[model samples]
Structure formats: structure tokens, C-alpha cells
Target: MREVMGECLPDVVRARQKKAFGGVQGEWLRKYHKRAVYGLLRSASFKKREYWNHLALMRKADAFFAGEGENSFFLWQCINLELWFRKFID
Candidate 1:
């Protein structure tokens, strides 16, 4: 494959390190879908869960929004879990 397309592809494109294909979910969560994500994360139903520390969750979320940390994976998991509960258990 490299031999066949290497001539047509730019050096950078052909020689670049491989990376896992990923979605912009983290960016979307932090930017485009911020309001909706925040709403779902902070909703009464979500906050009602005793396992999570509401204040800590908010602080963590604030940090993520402020670019103080890379907690997108954690936040994404939390959001998915909440959505799953709402869909199947709530």
C-alpha cells in the first residue's frame, strides 16, 4: 500500500505516525454541546444520585471547561451512564 500510494501522497502524510481514529466528542461536549451537556449533568435527576459528590462533580466539570485538566473521558463516561440510567432505569 505504501509503495503504491507513497508517490502520490505528501511526505508528511505518508510518513506521519499512525494515530487512533477518534471523534470530536470531547470537543463537542466542551464547546458546541456545552449547554446541553451541562444541563444533563446538573439536572435534578442526575444530582439525586447519592454516589456522586455534586460539589466535586461541578468543580471537576469547571476545571475541564477551564482547560485546567483532561478529564473528558471521565466526563463522557459519566454522561453516558446518566443517559443509560434515564433510558433504561429511570
Candidate 2:
């Protein structure tokens, strides 16, 4: 994801870059801006999924702990493991 973001950085910057001559931006510039915004929104959505998944896991862990013994330590460890896997997979 970082690599994708790094490659996208130039496209984002170029989309924002203004023309020096005639002070007028081209149609392609507007299109680039649209693409950049869409890319950013897509990235944000992907990140939000991670947050939501973690929240769901924490909720489940809480419920499990309430019924079972106080195994928060193990739950946290499992959460960490899952996060590690998600980071690589994502």
C-alpha cells in the first residue's frame, strides 16, 4: 500500500500543479484531479475497513471474555497477530 501510495504521490502532486503559462489549466488537468481524488477516497475506504474489522474483533473479544475467563491478554495477542497478518495481506 505504501508503495502504491508512493507511486500515486506524483500523480496527486501533478494533478494539483498549476500551469505557469496563460494561467489556464487544461481539461486533462481537471481529469487528473478527479482521478487523484478518487484514488485518495479509495485508499481511505481501504483503511477504514481495517479500523472497522479491528473494532468488530475487539467487540467479539469483549463478549467472549464476559462469558469465559478474563482472557484479555490472549485476546490482545490474537488481535496483534491478526493485525500483523492483515498488514501483510492488505
Best by lDDT: 1
Backbone clashes in model 2, listed as residue pairs: none
**The candidate that achieves the highest TM-score relative to the unseen native structure:** 1
Prediction 1 global C-alpha lDDT: 0.84
State candidate 1's TM-score.
Answer: 0.70
Cα lDDT of model 1 by residue, 49-77, tens digit: 87678778888888988899778888888
lDDT of 2 by residue, 50-90 (tens): 44454554455445434543444444454455456557865
Question: Candidate 1: misplaced stretches above 4 Å?
Answer: 1-23
Q: Could you tell me how far off, in angstroms, the CA of residue 88 lies in candidate 2 after the best superposition? A: 1.8
Candidate 2 accuracy as TM-score? 0.27
Whole-model lDDT per candidate: 0.84, 0.46
Worst 10 residues of 1 by lDDT: 22-31
